[model samples]
Target: MALSWDDEPTTAAPAAAAGNPEASAADVAKRVNADDKRIINAKTDVNQLVPFKYKWAWDKYLAGCANHWMPQEVNMQRDIELWKNPNGLTED
Candidate 1:
């Protein structure tokens, strides 16, 4: 199926606004230390070491949202272009 760049996904609330700060911090700590969260396979280890593959997939899924589609630096450039011209369509 063809993709539609005009349909951008909405960004969720910031972490601070999503929940209580203290609770969110505690949850983050818990997840970081949880043994069950440790890698169980080489695939997981590789993914952690090289995240670009996953990032590319995510970017493709969130196409029109340039913030998510590109890296931080590239996003900044794209943001400026997008601001000047709001249409999300890309040549790709």
Candidate 2:
């Protein structure tokens, strides 16, 4: 696939958005990974942006989002108790 930075975007790129507080655009029209299905030269947040090359990671992210969990909301008392219990578990 051929991508030219000179070519306009159908939708505004994140780097071009004034509303975006933080933006990183690659100076060259090349990607950090050319093989990945990403914009030709768009500078994107690796964590925020999903890459076609790493679809499994994206799937895991989606699965995690669906659960709608917060670290504070999780109860670790059971785990602590289990760790303290000598009979239930032992250190290898």
Candidate 3:
């Protein structure tokens, strides 16, 4: 596909870009205070990871790590040997 411009380009007067009133009004106090922070539409810095506002999230992460398991930690050698043996099972 090809695009063709039949009319000449024209320039219009530049307009000021609108800014968010809440974001523009943000101050250092808002960034430091976690009480005013929220999951969405927060006036504070969302990029900041330090000074955890929700302790429950951190606690849940720690608790979840306790049950972490991997296939490498399990012993499957006996199961594999039994599966490979022809006499281990009948026709069924």
Candidate-wise lDDT, in order: 0.54, 0.65, 0.61
lDDT of 1 at 46: 32
Candidate 1 per-residue lDDT over residues 14-60, each given as its tens digit: 56556588867766675343333445432343325334568777676
Q: Choose the strongest candidate by TM-score.
A: 3
Per-model tally of clashing residue pairs: 0, 0, 0
Candidate 3 local lDDT, 1-92, one digit each (tens): 22236646667433433465554355323445453334544456665755666899778767786789787889989888888998876677
Between prediction 1 and prediction 3, the one with superior lDDT is: 3
Superposing all C-alpha atoms, what RMSD in Å does each candidate have to the true structure? 18.0, 13.1, 19.5
Tens-digit per-residue lDDT, 1-92, candidate 2: 55786867676344645564344333334455533645666566444555546889889878888889777788989988988988869666
Candidate 2 — what's its lDDT? Answer: 0.65
Candidates sorted by TM-score, best first = 3, 2, 1
Which candidate leads in lDDT? 2
Off by over 4 Å in 3: 1-58, 89-92
The C-alpha TM-scores of every prediction are: 0.21, 0.25, 0.30
**Roughly what TM-score does model 2 have, to 2 decimal places?**
0.25
Candidate 1 is scored at a TM of 0.21
Clashing pairs in 1: none
